[model samples]
Target: MVLYTLAPGIRLSFNEIYTSSWEKGDSSIFGERMLIVNFCIHGRCDVSLAKNRYAIVKENQVCISTVMPTKDFYYPRSLYEGIQLYLDLDILHDENGQDFLSALGISLEQIVEIFCEKDGLYLHQMNDTLRTLVKDAWDGKDDIEIGTLRYLAVRLLHEIMSMPAESETETYFTRSQIAMVKEAETLILSDLTTRITAKELADRFGVSESSFKFYVKGILGDSYLNYFRKKRMEKAAELLETTNLKVIEIASAVGYENQGKFAKVFADTYGVSPLEFRRLSK
Candidate 1:
């Protein structure tokens, strides 16, 4: 993939139909101080950050990230392409920008959570109005026309943020609990290669092991290790679909040293082998 950095603070990086293969086992620390807003225009892609993983960011889906020192990769490899909009906090606070942020119920902390949390995909219906706005900007013939599209893009982001937060009942974790759980998840994902025990995690979070276990189980209805394993497996699934990496390599990247055990667990969780799942996705 071709990488470019537009204007230092506020810029748009566009890549059209860029095709490339991601290494089987690769991870990097994403630098900080920028907001990444990606739009999937032509084909599908997946990204794994921390412990969360997303698949097939279909056309029109927007994925935003603010955290740094993380890893991301793509899968399915179908002409893999998209646009990355990077904005600094200052640009996001312009008069018009302030209005947009208010509309989305966005706070500085919430923006950080959006990127650091596992659920990064935000789905919105592409109605006529939205479609027309996109068409005018992306299909426009010149720079001046394309610049006008930025306003519409801001409005679209507002519309997305304005949508009610997903119902709490729909998620096993309550809103407050989710924040805490997400913080814990970030820790787990940051170093998947190491062995982490529940007691150690509990101490780090300043709670007794029993209380920590209770908190995790109450929200996710599962033990800490189980939840951690699920997150790793989810990351593996994304890699399997997006990269040409072998199953063993993917397994190791997500903290599994035993490929056989990893395969069995993955198949049981997904109802199909990783190879089979990747083939079907393609």
Candidate 2:
């Protein structure tokens, strides 16, 4: 964790990696009455909210919140890598000990109001511009000068303040729905030899196939068949590189009944045949 205090009440921190379920909030030093901007590069975030509810922040998305979590932030996958910018409005002040935010006018606040949920979180898909800025910062965060950090922080805010509200309605999943999707992952992925159609899986879960696909896309970031195929190909590649199995045997092990089809798909996925991949691994 690298934290840069850009100004009196504004700061940015780089969360490189956290392999834990929960992160105890330590922002007490920054005080309450805060606004947070989270840019997720990978992993998922579960922000504790009022009324025993939690808001999710998926990879490649931004989460803005006006209220700080009362206890800890939860990472459902036990992983989180991202950047968070904190603005403690209560402690924000100028050199003259005045409210410096007044200088920002109402544009910033308007943006916040438009996105912030009531004791929840407002999540947005980050644009390419913001993604590049955040990615560059995350890549060279330690080397950035203080002045440059300040500029980046302000520029990020400015970029966000300029975005118009989204016209498409955002969707929120219940905890039960999320749990159901995770169970589907285990059911299908644990044994790749059998193909499970999305309709079959959804029927087992008692959800519409369309809704099931939506949940999968939102939580896992991939459609059902593609995700399964990707895992199968990855497993096949691993076997080719590590084991002494023949190409046909490796193909069967990864649920491919036809060696010719397997080779074609493997070549498409990795641009190499199984035997060629093995040679390259050596």
Candidate 3:
């Protein structure tokens, strides 16, 4: 795949047709609020979002995600090819911010509703006509002029802004609770070798132990113990696949004192023993 800056605050990433599926870690973290449109011109892929949400984009389909901090990955299957258009809000703000919104038939209230008021990922599927237009633009991305690309982006976004807001799940966590949950995730994952208990996490975050657990469950949709176990398993798997450490050492690295228990959990999680997994990965 290749990424090209078609214009300021606008970029296109595409790849030549390939028989094998596209698979890689996409750790591109956007700093500010931005609009992104993804066009699956020639393949199907699964996108992973935080908090256990996922979106699947298929051939000839388009998906839009509004302003938010994003950390995601795409796993494509088959002749995987696609283009992503990034619209930076700062550049689009212009001299008078209202002018840009007016030109696109979007209002400040609507922007807030779709981008800020919402929780989790704000993604919506485009109608078929808009989908075709997006696909056409992406298919010709390599040859399209900058002006034409900008025009296409605006047109696509106008339609996207007009779509109905996605229904939101009832979130029980307040803003502070949500922030604490994020902090908790960082702290837990920060040290893999230490088993940090829920009480310890609550103490560190300065929240009551029960309240901390409640907020974490609300945000992650999993209990603290379950979530902690999952993270440790993920670390163990990464170590097994990427390092030359022995199984016992790997077990110790991820907070498991007993190698036998570690092997059993690894097998349950990955359907293979750690040694076999290492061999297969290689």
Candidate 4:
């Protein structure tokens, strides 16, 4: 387990877990009253709350739980890997934070209801935007500093409370199906030079074309082509900022055959052309 204390009210933990079969532990939530968001980046685990009551947090899923200072929660761990955040919601009452939350359509009472009241453990598959944001939070990428993390935690609360009802796709998907989707993602990110089609990926993974597309859409919150292009564009930007590669070389590296088209997309994504980005970075 790796931990980061970004502030007094916010702490982040990234756990690379390998426990004995059926290992058990007492979660310190019994003594802490805070909002917790756990992202199961890989693997899964079951959390036992009260007698004969439990919640299973699946892989690639996220959960929000509110802890009571006097309640005991048991974790009968299987192999678990995840990133978790501890957020002291009381911090929001300071200054104009509550007002800021209200502007975002969230109120302290609502937050309390979602995080402090009821059974209080909620789980859902993250939409692509939130998925990426959580990953950035773990990777310490993009400007996810202490202040940004606080903002993200608040935004996360908004998302959790506002998410729509579960669809059939979310309600049921086998581990094999999840693995197929992850394999497809691996293939997409494997080679930036090659143009990979959804059909080709489906065929490679032995899944039907439509089902593969649907699964990718459900997990990534975008069409496969759109997501792939976004990743490629991000790669192009990295090359521009870190290397002395020419525009044509960068474009080619990102699977763009036409430099002009690449320039247009890059400008749209970064508000400047590739050369300008490079110059600014330097």
Give the top-scoring candidate (lDDT). Answer: 2
Please, what are the lDDT tens digits per residue for candidate 2 over residues 60-159? Answer: 8887777566556655445789989888765663333443344544344665667764433577778888898888988887688987877777767777
lDDT digits (tens) for residues 1-282 of candidate 3: 666665454565665555322433343524365666676666555454445444455566565555342333333222456667665656556534544435556453455457446553444455786777777876676687766765776676677666667733334334456557767777767788888889998898888999888877655656898777877887888888889999999999888999999899889888999999999989
Candidate 3 weakest lDDT stretch, 10 residues: 69-78
Worst 10 residues of 1 by lDDT: 20-29
- Which residue pairs overlap in candidate 2's backbone? none
| Best candidate (score: TM-score) | 2
lDDT per model, in order? 0.57, 0.74, 0.64, 0.65
Provide the lDDT at 109 for model 1.
40
Shift in Å, residue 32, candidate 3: 14
lDDT score, candidate 1, position 258:
93
Reference-based TM-score of each model: 0.40, 0.74, 0.50, 0.49
- The 10-residue segment of model 4 with minimum total lDDT is 69-78
Query: Could you give the candidate ranking by lDDT, starting with the highest?
Result: 2, 4, 3, 1
TM match of model 2 to true structure: 0.74
lDDT at residue 197 of model 1 (Cα atoms): 81
For candidate 4, give the lDDT of residue 255.
Answer: 89
**TM-score-based ranking, best first?**
2, 3, 4, 1
Residue lDDT tens for model 4, 1-282:
666666555676676676412323235422245676778876565554433334456677877767332222212222466777766666644535544445556564565575446566667787876777667766764345656755766676566666543311323344566557656766666778888889998898887899988877654456877767777888998998888889999998988999999999989888999888899988
